[model samples]
Target: MCSSFRSLLPALRAFTAKCPPPQICTSLRTYATEAVPDFEHKPSHYGQPLFQSHPHLLRPHELTPGIPSEEYERRRKDLMDSLPSNSVVVLIAAPVKYMSGSIYKYRQGSDFWYLTGFEEPDSAVVLEKNASSRGYRMTLFSNGKDSAKEKWDGPRTGFDDALNFFKADDALTIKAFPAQLRSMISLYSNVYIDLPQSPRKNARSTKSLLRYLSPPVNPRSEYETVVESLSSSRRKPLAPHIAQLRAFKSVCEQQVMRMAADISGRSHAKTMRFTRPGISESALAAHFEYLCSLSGSQRLAYVPVVASGPNALIIHYTSNNQVVQDGEMILMDAGCEYNGYASDITRTYPANGSFTPPQRELYSAVLSAQKALVGLCTEAEGLSLHDLHRKSCDFLRRELKQIGFTLHTGDLERVLYPHFLSHPIGIDLHESSYSDRGESLKAGMVITVEPGIYVPPTAQFPKHFHNFGIRIEDEVLVGEKHPVVLSVSAPKEIADIEGACQGLLGLEPI
Candidate 1:
């Protein structure tokens, strides 16, 4: 307790004398509290539905319907893990399209939505990983909040809240995206992106952030331009990597796909019951779309093909304007999109509620082949799509021969079965279009099994069966032991289809 304590007492007394009093301190506290910005006042709406705003449509942790935020995070992590160190992944959002002055409905790009689940346009994401860190950093670039713009269009999840809302490491206004991307390209050793060429005509608004990045050019695409500007060897196509990941669906994705299939299948059944001899093909198509929308589907997956009589012989016949004759058959190929998933189904039935003798015979042959092929969509079968196609050709040839029509092996494939047997299905109607169909089927992979026989009026076939076309398509999910038919609700049996057309089965609205 000695000289040290005595020396500090004078300095402590001087410091206490200079400090503010209690009242002054209180005033200082009040001023500081008032100076801090208020962060609790959030916007009443956002570009997409949130659990807080739309509790009925979303759960607490879900980013999109049936897809949780954690899954999206995992997807990003998986992609980063696949790439080497010091690599960057760039993804762009889909731009809003306009037909004249009216705006068409907006849809996010499939690969972009698969990773971030952000449904807004004029946005982009950059994911970066360095050798020193085990994890990647996600930066989201979006529009900043503007009261004037928000008044005209709906609310936006501006850059200020994007970090927390989207679980991004950093967020900035989209205006800064170009500079940021250029900096990332210079710093990172590898760049993974997929930017297609933009069309010269029908350019987007000048104010759009994406339009600013990629202006309408003549021959080179946005990708080509980037490659020419930067080191082409350092850039890699990102789609094939993402496509491999999306090929096998998670459990939640499977559930969403099943719901999509159910909605579309039930709609097809309802359309069959509503069809009559005098109904126009266009009206039937509209009615089918109505049923799909009424039963929770967001929109049609693609343009529907509602063909009657000889029109069925033409593949991809979408001009549904013809009138149905009493004796002719109606072939409808349609599907619906639910949430982000899609479902495809096809059903051909008699317009007059009864098939002629030739119609039944041809339909039975195609139905038998389709049923057998669907069973092959299993891991245990160890068959690729090409294998199924060959098997289908054999089945059709035998069935046609049994039906009193002699067809050579080459004639069956060249003339009758023109299209491939199956294709992958998920987010887009033709999901992973670049994937090899020769690869063997794996569990959790969903695909379509379609078999059709189109007989034109020629000397090789009998007159009764001429001008008859029949097709049966269904969605199948490959399983470990057995295949699950997602579109089983749409009746395929001869008796069941006939019963549905005759109104014998008491079917309810989906």
Candidate 2:
């Protein structure tokens, strides 16, 4: 080590030792010993870092434009053909929110990113789908600059680069969106807008896009919320045409998602080696991001959940405080983003060396259910996400009964098991896709089959089961031949996990 690095080594070791051992970190807790090659004993750079994919995996899409602008022309033609001849479709990038007063993080809307690869915020895209394919054109509207703001926040792509680099037909200052919207709608008979399903301040772009279209517009929200509650502040309705376009993933999209899942697998394994009792949950979160950085991921797909103990019961827990308990299980629900695609994975494991009986039982129940459901991802026949979820729920119901717990006879499905077992996981954790009553399974789709059993902190259950919540999640690619478990590097078997913990205890971070 260099003189400075050598002197700082003690301090770094002290800091890492105080944090949870990397083996048990939420990102890597369930990774089997065999899944991660022993890198500690080897020279530092002999192999890629735990989370980094081989350079061979980083190649761009192979499909090339047949003609100079064929790809763009094809995309533009398809988009225009789907809408009315005289219609305008508007899509906006979601803005970032500050975690505190100054520090902030953000993720752009997948639909917006899919259409335009620009990563900037306060940006909106307008597609004028006109009578003739040749007449069709697209434009982007985004923020210019305020020297004071740029100095503090750093640089942005702005409108000029968006037009020249992103190749939008035209680019305009966001200040002109209102005037442009009014002008565009006057000439067009129909208007389309892409709006989020939730209430958002930055979603004002959707509202602005829709209101300018016309007086009467689509009234349905695009997001699924908590069981029965509806947000009064939900964004303006979605444009059907735009949604229809998003239903199918482009070849480039599938490649990006595949790469994201690959990187996430490594990150999860790296995190597994970092976990131990007495470590703060926040440090684990930091460890997750660190692995993502070590790899080529752009950012986290969503707010990472590093919940430990009873905090794990809170499904969306993001406050990663509290010292991990020796025997308690930590539930981490996290994802990594590359380019713009996302990969989500969740795993629950003991903070100590292994799981207790109750934890094992609950975990095994979820694991069996997940396995049974994922087995359906075969070329011969397969189930849809919602169908698999329902199957998992049925399995959970049976398992609960087998364990002397009965539902519905006493209103079980609703009271005991309330949440759905699976969801689409992509650019969004609860990503966009239909799964309500009768959606069918489709190939080339990505989804998460996460079956969780939440035994609340109540006395109705045994003390051993009280406050214990376990969820095992894997990112899966629905394939024609078989379902690909993208996060396969993480171990789910009880024996494998226990053995991994036993071996990794007291080890230093590699």
Off by over 4 Å in 2: 1-76, 93-103, 131-135, 143-164, 194-239, 378-385, 401-412, 433-437, 456-464, 503-510
**Model 1 worst lDDT window (10 residues):** 24-33
Clashes of each: 0, 20
Which lDDT tens digits does candidate 1 get at residues 1-510?
235644676687588679863321121112212334434434456778766555545678888877898899889888999999888998888866789988888888999999899988788899997553537999998876778888988788867567767899899877666667767777877889875544656453222324533432213243343344444577777889899999998888887788788778888888888888888999999988998887667789999999999999998999999999999988899999987999999999988778788899989989988998898889999999999998998888888889989776567888877888888999999998678889999999999999998888998887898888899999998999798888887988877687677765556433
Q: lDDT tens string, model 2, 114-185? A: 566555667678788765536577888776555665666555554654565557889887656655655665
> What clash pairs does model 1 have?
none
Best by lDDT: 1
Per-residue error for 221 in candidate 1, Å, reads: 16
